[model samples]
Every structure is written in structure tokens, then in C-alpha cells.
Target: MPTQTRRSPPDGYYRTTVSSLAIALSAPAVAQETTGPDDGEVRAEQIADERRENPVDSIIVVGGRIDPYRIAGSADLIDSEDLRRFDYGDVNRVLRQVPGINTQEEDGFGLFPNIGLRGSPVERSSNITLMEDGVLIAPAPYAAPAAYYFPAIGRMQAVEVTKGAAAIRYGPRTIGGAVNLRSTDIPADGLAGYAFGQYGSRDYYQGQAWVGGDTDYVGALLETYQQGSDGFKTIDGLPDADTGFERQDYRGRLAVHTAPDAPVEARLEFVYGRSDLEANETYLGLADTDFAAEPYRRYAASQRDAFSGEHDQYRVTGSLAFSDGTRITATLYRNDFARSWSKLQDIDFDGDGSFDSISSVFVNPEDNAGALSILRGADSFEGAVRIRNNNRVYRSEGAQISLERPFEMGGARHNLAVSVRYHEDEEDRLQNEEFYSQIGGDLVFERQTDLGQQANREAKAKAIAFYIEDRIEIGALTLTPGLRYEGIDLTRLDYAGSDPDRSNGPTRVRQTNIDQWLPGLGATYELGDAILLAGVSRGFSPPGPGNPDARAEESWNYEAGVRYRSDKVQVSAIGFYNDYSNLLGNCTQSVGCSVGDIGDQFNGGAVTVKGLELSAAVEPRLSNSVSFPLSLAYTFTDAEFDSSFDSEFFGDVNEGDDLPYIARHQLYVEAGVNMGRAAATVGANYVSELRDNPGSGAVAENERIDDRIVFDIAGSYALTDKFSLFARVDNVLDNQYAVSRRPFGLRPGVPRRIVGGARVSF
Candidate 1:
């Protein structure tokens, strides 16, 4: 094993007293242990220990799973051990274990995850703050918060979620809380590395590797991950067509630091990452009857649908710590993303010029018999099927600086943090459409429109944000009060569809300016092995560039919870209420919006979302050589609109209409058996029925997504000190369930999958 030199804690006074609480309130943390070599585990353990002894080292919410009892608000950590047990590449599957989280799956895999926290809406995951290594990771978070490009979860080391007042420290969107993805870290000692490979059902395969080394003054790291699958869905009349996807990611890091004992220790690091994805995916779904007969079948018209994307990220971070207990950190980052998704948009059965949306056809199949026949490849159509290339490019760049200081005042220990950031982001859209005819179950190209004929626009935003938070401790009580301010300027430029080069200037220009202040307060009291926590926070979600008159989504969020921990058991329960003064919705193609209506925003009056979250974990030894570990998480939610409204996106709403796509109840359970070097685990998740549209009371047959339950199992055994073998079966019951009914028709969840892999370390 390699040896490491320990660095002194940031502040000796706080280290011996309330460092854990201070760290939890201030910064991001490495909150999980590694499942690699012995050295990797040791390094992870050391980092956790260091966090407990250093107040300024952590910069985000939530510390580690080992110390959730110390958190002052609702938070959770999905550590490495939990991730290794299932080896899931889909973020949707991993997040099911966390309470108070909801997901609407798309594309079977997690390619375009629709995530919601607390009571926020789950549309493209646009209502929450998303980050990686404490830096904002969403493409064009301000100009276009829709998450068309999400980080590859398989390359991450840990996942962290924070809610309520604890989440006030980060944002542009604070209503739904925040999610942070922690990437691999540079080794703390000599050379260290690990490699993992897996192959599974449906011709699926994945490979990942990382290597890193650290010296007294310098460190470097490199990592790569690749995955592919010949999807589980089959298209009509196309036996050889692949409904699969391929993805690749590469990252590199370099760092330089001063000597361990220097008066003012400092470190500077740089990171670069690139990723590419190509998927044969579509936004087409099936009719109710067709879905029941073949849940994993693709329509003949969607056989040519495809999506491709590329992303590049660059970041530089620097931090300095003074001997007198002051620390400052700064980061500069940039990201570029581009994607093109070509799919069927509409069809015209008659010779008339008017066209009908694909969703309309599915809703009233009898009225669109001719169009249905064309889609099923049972009849010939002439230039009726329209396919659009939804092309867009996004860029985000920002600089942030934060300072932390610990002090004592009025007989109370206090840790204060202040941060400021300047950010700019833009989204450019240049799209076109093509006509195709189906004859003899094959599509023939008719004519292609000029580039930019479908859409030609650019949205830009520049924002400045400042926030200050202070954590004060007296006796067994800790209180944190924070305030945040954001000022943003948004602009949208639209060009005529016939002018791709913009020689005649923009046809329309819109500008909007917004400023808001958010405040939060949290309190926690420790009593024996149990802690009581409560918080109240202001929630805000900025409007996109397309809507200059649209009001930002604002709410008042409140929560109270209790946590208890013993030697072998841990439990927590939280109750939360979010009162939305203004609920906002964005129209996108994924939500069954027409091409012309995409990017529009709708306002829904008053709304209320109340929920309860409960989680428990226990580990018991059955005998000298056997141990059983079990965990459970459950959530119950009640959400409804307080006022009636009408819009293109929300259809017709009543005063008591419930929010769509949000399950009333969700539960997850897991159990594991461990015997020395061998372990096996099983997990199950349950979701209650959901609505496809806003309504109350009884659900209509056409607007319901039935309840579902899924099970998964995994086992692992150590062959040697440096080698381990693992295998897993997902959806063991082989149940076919409807996951969503949007963008056209009914969609199915992932089918049964089996995967086996091995791990090697040095």
C-alpha cells in the first residue's frame, strides 16, 4: 500500500469542536467510501476523516452517509458502496433509493431523465439546480435550463442531494433543491488505478478505467468510460434496424499545491472532459391498444429517427487557506454542447395543406384512420410524413469566488461564508424539416427544406449572483441563516425562417431583466442520539429567454424532520410543504408540444405541494460469519392547483386539479447478505398510479399510468485481493409497465436485463 502525508486541519479551533457541522453547511464533500483496492478505500476513509476535522474543506450540502445525523436539514448521500452493489448506469435506477425524489423515465435508459424533488415539476429536470464537483453542469442553465445533456452517471464516484434551507447556498433554481455529482479524485499517495468492464443482456456492454498519482507538490488523474447497447425495442417491418445507443466519455485533471507545512497553503487544479453520444431514439409512442399488445415496439414511421450529441467541459479551480482560519476558493468553468434529433413531427392524411400532430392521431385514432394506416406501413402515403431535425448548440461560462471564516461572537461559535458569481449562457437553434412517403413498408425521401426553415433563433442570458450564509452554534442548538440575490438580463433574437444567414438582420428581438432576493433559516437541536431539524426557505426558478413577460416560479418551502442513529440502525422522517405563488411551465417537444409552440411558457396560478419522506437502515449480524443489511425509503405526496387556468400546454385546469406525472406514493426497499468476501443483495421499487393530464377524482381511461413494481438482484465475490467478480439482474420479474404517455403515445419502462462484470485494481 502507498503511504500518504496528512495535512493539518484548516482551523484547529473548529477542528476540535464543531467542524462537522461547519463543513456540512459550507462546501461539497466526498461523502462515500470507494469499492476499489484497499488503497482506494483507505484514501476515501482519509478524506472523510479530514472533512470532519476541517471546516472550510467542504463547499456543498450534505457531508457523508456515515454522519447524516449531523445535517441540519433534509439531505441524502448515495455512496460508492451503494453504487457498487447494483452497478447501475442509469441515474433513474440509482435515485430510486433516495426519499422525496421522483423520476419520469424516457428512452428506457437515463438518456433524458425527467427528475423532480420535493413537489417540483418533472419536465426535463429544469426546475432544480444540477452540478458536478460543486460546479453548475446544466447546459445553458439560465438561457435554457432544460437538461438535454446530462452527465454520464457511470463516471461519477458519489451522488449528493440537499433540500430546504440547506439548498439555499446554491442556485438559479432553488424550488426543487439541488443535485451534485462527484467525480473521481486524484489519489492522495503514489500511483493508483482501477479498471471495470461489464457485459449484459440485449448486447449491452460497458467499460470504465481511471488512474491517478499524487506527490507532495503535484498530482494528475485521467479517466474514461464507454457504453453501448443493441436496445430492447423492435421496430415494425424492420428486423435488422438497431434501436440502440453508444456513448463515450473522457476526462483529465492536473493539480499543483504548496508544501504541506507552508504558512498559507494553496492548491490549483484544472479539468477537461469530452463526451459523445449517438442513439437511435424517437419521440413516437403507440396507441393504447398497441401498447398493451407490444410495449417495446416501434412504429414503422419512427425507424429512421436518430439522435446525436457532443459535449466539452473545461474548469480551473484554486483554493487558499490561511493559518488564522480563513479560506478562499475560486473557480472558472466553460461548457459547450451540441445535439441534433431527427424524428417524425406530423402527418397529413388528406390532400389539404393543414397537418395534424402525431399526438392527435393517437388520441383519436378512429378520426385518423388514414394517418394510422400510413404510420403502421399498411398503406402508401405521398409526402405526408414530416420529419424535423431539432438542432441546437449551447454554451455556458462562469466564474465564482467564495470565502469562509470561523469566529466566536456573543458566546456562540459561528462560521460565515460569502460567495459571488458571474455567469453567461446562450442557446442557438437552426433546424429544418423533410418530407417522406411510405410505400411497401419502406420510407422514400420526397423533398428536404432549406436549413433554418423550421426554426431560427438564439437566446442569451447574463447573470450575477451573491449569497451569504452563517452557521451559529450555542450549546446543543445550531442555527443557519442565509440570503441570496440574483440579477439576470435575458435576450432573444429571432430570424426569418427563409434567412439562414441572417443577412437582413433579426426579425424580432426581446429583452427582459429580473432581480430577486431569497432568504432561508434553519435550526437543529441534538438530544442524545436523536436530532430535530426544521427550516423555511424561499424558492425561485428563473424564466427562460423565450418568455420576456413570464414571471419566475416562486414559492415558500417549509420542512421539519427528525433523525436518529444507533450503533446498527439509522432512521429519519421529514414532512415538507411548498406553497407556490406562481407555477410556471415550459413547452418542449418532449411534452407533446407542437413545433411552433415549443419554448413557450405558461403560468399557473396558486399551487400547493405537501409530502412526507421516511427512510431507515439497519444492519444485524446473524452469526459470526454472516450479516444482513436492510434499508427502506418511502414518500407520500399531495399536490394540487389552487386556481383554475387555461393554456396550450396545461390544457384546461380546474381549481382542484392535481399535478400531472407525479405519483401519490413511492417506496423502495433493499436487503443484502454478507459473508466475509461474498455478498448478495436485492432491491424493489414501487410507484403508484400517475396522471397524464391535470385532473381530479377518478382518472379517465385515456389519462392514466397504472402503478408498477420492479425488482433487481446482484451478487459479488472476491477472487483475490486485487480482483472481484460481480453480476446483476434488473427487472427480475420481467414486468412490462407504462412509464409515460407523452410526446405522442404510451411508452414502456425498461425490460429485464442481466449484466456481469469484473473489477481490477493496482
Candidate 2:
């Protein structure tokens, strides 16, 4: 077992009296709540089996189920057991521990994930490729990638993140890397089922159950999760309206041998999700002073905001095995999503027809204090409020086929793979605006906008892609080289400000095509007892249609790392550099960008991102019935703009300025004790200060989100072989820290919450 040294605490004064924990008024938290790891790096069985093997041995990992030791890329695996240990219902909270990925909490609900991979823009997770069951899962990957619709992480079986040169197989946003979520596989043996539920602060509630079984010729699984909450923030003078959300998710799968003796297996799956929310969320945020005074308060202007949405997916998959180490797998899939949000947009506080966007008022509060105070019900104001009904419908479907074969040639071994995919996606957006007259903090319906639609447009893309890769091995060295080809036809029709129904005007249609070849290579060498790896890849992300001169976001990405593995300990260190020729950002209406429609793009000329990641874990062999587990992860990233350019979203930027919101340093630590059927774990996380704009030395008070440190603890006790009691507490420190400085002012992290529940298997 690996050993660790502990240091004693420094001598300090001890206060005579004690309190629960330090909490910020209206700050909503007592913790930094940084993400850490459990036993979630790999599958429980796989990790156990590999622990007994040589560290340098090649074995399939959860990342594409590819052999990690043989690949030249960086990958991280999040297993199911780890999810249970962390109670990972929030994707942003858990992914924080995964180095190279930066997360910004939007609305604190994990409802819409905003993540940037190695310096990609952290908006709606549009810069990276998102997949489920090894298939594309975004609402519209090619046609439009902004304003994403994220998946619920509570029900996922595993999450596989592959970065740098290793992500060549996935497109069209290869520059940021890929996140693939693997769903639970149906049982191949006897019946199995489990159910669990928990209740937390702010009326939070969660419950889920799943059952699966297999027969001689058929296998089936059924699962459902229903969760909801009455939100934390209350609106002034409107105590009756709840400010939270509710959602129900269902998934089912059936696999049939069809011909029991045939060499093929097939499965069909269906996934359905629906959610309704009456939230007080808005683009408006408090000023620095106001935040310091009341960080959790909501203004009266946004009392009427609400949202609702639905998503559905259907897929058919099959696999074939041949006699000589060859196999083929294929899938046909389709997804549909629709959403509508009714919220306040602009306010004419003085009835002056000269309206100010709510976002502007929040971002520049010092100049808009009069209007801000009036909107907060501090003073009377005669004005007309502008409300926009934002609605959109999306559809995506695709077919993919892949082939794999292994053979030996010239005294060496080689693994070969080939695949082809055709995908099509479309987005239809039609929105309307309604005017209201405000008197005494209450709104009276005035009239609908004479302009047909606040936002009206459609985008579509049809793409064909082919990929091939070869892995060659000689002695203790392995090399992999891969290539991918993408050809896409994109089209957009803008009825901007006109009715989508063609009732009020004509439409302007535009078309564009993009073709590119992306290449990647990786090498791994097994040393005396350690593993050395290196890789380089060409990354690509295409611009949406309608912009004839919009160049694709391209980069040369490089990575190198080393790893050591054993039965009791594992460690790894990796470094990556991404040199970008172009970076892209889209104006999102939700973020207060109304210069054009929702899908407009702005290009940032040149950028560079370099980072380092370190990780270690140890599980010492203690007594026959007791053992301890500890793990640590750290990240350091230096991201900056290489070219001086002006961005509509980020304002002005000079060369050498740090990119917005990319934390320079992050650290995570976790320790746990296991005694037979009972287990306890505690963890802490720290993140350095982050900036919202490019600036010189010190982080300007206005452009900075303060650093944070958070803690968490959880325990589970098994009463029998089939049942267990569990409890958890988050933000144990109750530290108040800024999680985001976008969409307006500071948005706080999740507040302190305690939950207890039971897990039962039958």
C-alpha cells in the first residue's frame, strides 16, 4: 500500500464559543463545493481487475472502451459507483474535478451546462461534441450549436471524456474535445432492480428506480426518474409564486437475439424527457454593493418569467462478430426537442420609448441606478416593460456504421478501424414580444409588438463524415495515426423580425458548404515500470451557415503524459497546448445579446491555451475489515488572446490578456474510510480567481470573481445485502463565493443542503 505523510496544524487561538459554519448573508452557500473524485475513475470491475495486472499492460478503458495504455490521448472515466458516492445529480459540480474542463454555473440548477474544454467558449457547451451511447446527442450539432439542451446526469451509467489528439473520431466541434455518456447495459443474467430517493433543503426532492433482466433470447430494462424543487429565492411582494422546476425522465431498452445461434445481436432504445419551470431567473444581476448586501434577492421586474420544454430520442443498434477477431457495429438514431421561455427583455422606465435592456442596466448599474431602483420596487416608475416569448423547435437524426479488425503483419501486430456517418439537423426559431405598462411594480398588458416576431429564423445542415485509424505495435511501443473527413452543406433562412408563418413578410435564404480533413497521431512507450505518451492532432469546428467568409475555428492541439499504476495506487500527469487560429462566439438572446437574431457569430482572431493536470489516488490495505481511500487532482491553465481584437460580447481585448472565466489554478482532495458494509467520505476543493475580461496584472475588482474553497461529506451504511442507508451534506463550510460574473452580476454557487435517503435492491 502507498503511504502518506500528514502535517500537524499550526498553533492558533481557540475561540471560547463555536458556531455551525460561516455563512454569507443572502450568499446562498457555506462552501466552495469544489468537485472531487470517488472510486469513479473507471468501472468497478475493470479497475479491480486491472489493479492486479501490470500497470504497463494494455486494457480497454471506459473512454470509447478503448485501450488507454495503447492510446496517445488524454482520457478520464467516471464510473457508476463514483456517481453514487458523490450523489452526482449535478453535471457541473462533478465535472469540476475533471481537469481541462472549465464550468460556469448558469442559474445554479445544472439545467443548462456551460462548459469550455481547454479554452473553448463556455456558453451552452456548444464548442465540444456531446454524445450518448457513442452517438451524437446535441439538439443541432451543425445547423446551430448555441443555446444547448443538456442531458440529465442523474441517470447516466458512465461519463467518458477524451481530449487532445484522442478525439479525432468525433466531430464537428473537435477543437474542444468530446464527452460521451454511456447508458446502463441490460442485464444478461437474472432479474436486477434498485430504487433510491432523497429530500434536501429548499424543498429539493429526488427519486429514481430501475429494473432489468435477460432471458435466453431477449433482454429488457426499464427506468424512470422524477425530480422537482421549490426554488430558494423569493420575489418581493410576490410570496405565492414558486421559483423552481420539475422534470420527469424515462428510458427503456429491449434487445433480442433474434436468431440465438446467429453471430449478431440487436437492441432498440427509447428515451423521453419533459420539464416545467416557473422560475424567477433572469439576465438581471445585482451591483457589487447590492450583491454584498443581498446576494439572494430577486427584483420585481422578473416575476413573470417562466419556462417549459420536452425532449425525445429513439435509437436502433446492432453488432456483428466474425470468426477472426473482426467486428462491426451500427446504429440508427433520431432526437427531437422543443422549448419555450417567457421572460422580460427590455424596460422603458420613463415611458420614454428609449428603452434600456435589462442586461445593460445590470452590467452598468452605476449609470442605471435610477432605473434599477425603480425596477426593484424602491420607487414608483411609469414605464412600458417589454416581454419576449422565446420559442424554438429542433430535430436531429443520423446513421453510423463502424468496422474493426485485428491482424499481424511483418512480425508486428496492428488494429484497424473504419467508419462512416451521415447526420442531419435543423432548428426552427419563432418568437414574439408583448408590451406592458408598469405601475407600482405591477405590469398591465398594453399591446403586442407591431413587429411580427422578436426573433424568427431557421437553420439546417446535412453532413457526411468518414474516419479511419490504425494502431500498430512493436515490442513495448505503440503508435496510432488517424484521419477524418467532413463534408457539410449548411442553409439558413432569415425572416428576421417577420412572422415565421410567412404571414407578415418574405424570407431571405442563404447557403454555404464546408469541407475539411482532420488528422491525428499518438505514441505510447512502456518504460521499465512507467508509461510515456505523446500526441498531436488537428482540431476543427465549422461556422454555421449564412456567413460566406466565416472561417472555421481551427487549432493544432498537442498532449503528452505519463502514468503509473499498481494494486494500491495510481498516478498520472499530463500537459496540453492548443494554438488556435480562430475562436468563435455566438450571441445568445438569453445572455442579453439582441443586436441580431440568436444565431449570429463573432470571431476572435488568434488565441492560445496551455495547461497541466496532475492526479493521484491511494487505497491502503488496513485491517481485515477496514481500509482507507484518498485521491487528489490539480489543474493549471494559461489562456490568452494572441491577437488584439474587439468582441461584441467581451468588449475590448488587447494581446496577452487572459481569456475570460478560465481559472488559472484548481485543486481537489478527497479521503474516505471503508469498514465492511459502511463507508464515509469527505472532500474539499479550491479554485483561483477568474476574470471576465482581458486585463493587466491584478484582477480588477469589477472584472474578477473571487476565489473559492468548498467542502462536502457523505456516509453510507449497509443494513443488509440488499439495502443501505445514506446521507450527504454539501457546502459544509458555508463559504460565500462568486460562481459566475456573466449574464449580468455575480451568481452564487449552490447553498448548503443536507439530504438522507435509502437505496434498496430487489
The list of candidate 2 runs beyond 4 A from truth reads 1-67, 258-280, 378-383, 450-452, 496-498, 503-506
What is the lDDT, from 0 to 100, of the residue 436 in candidate 1?
84
| Per-residue alpha-carbon lDDT of candidate 1 for residues 541-592, written as tens digits (9 for 90 to 100) | 9887666557889999999989998898999999999999999888898998
- Write down the TM-score of every candidate: 0.92, 0.89
TM accuracy, model 2: 0.89
Instruction: State the lDDT of candidate 2 residue by residue for 631-725, as single tens digits.
Output: 88888999888988776655688999888778899888889999999999888888899887676589878878999898989999999999999
**What number of clashing residue pairs does each candidate have, in the order they appear?**
5, 7
Q: Give candidate 1 misplaced runs (Cα > 4 Å).
A: 1-58, 61-66, 623-625
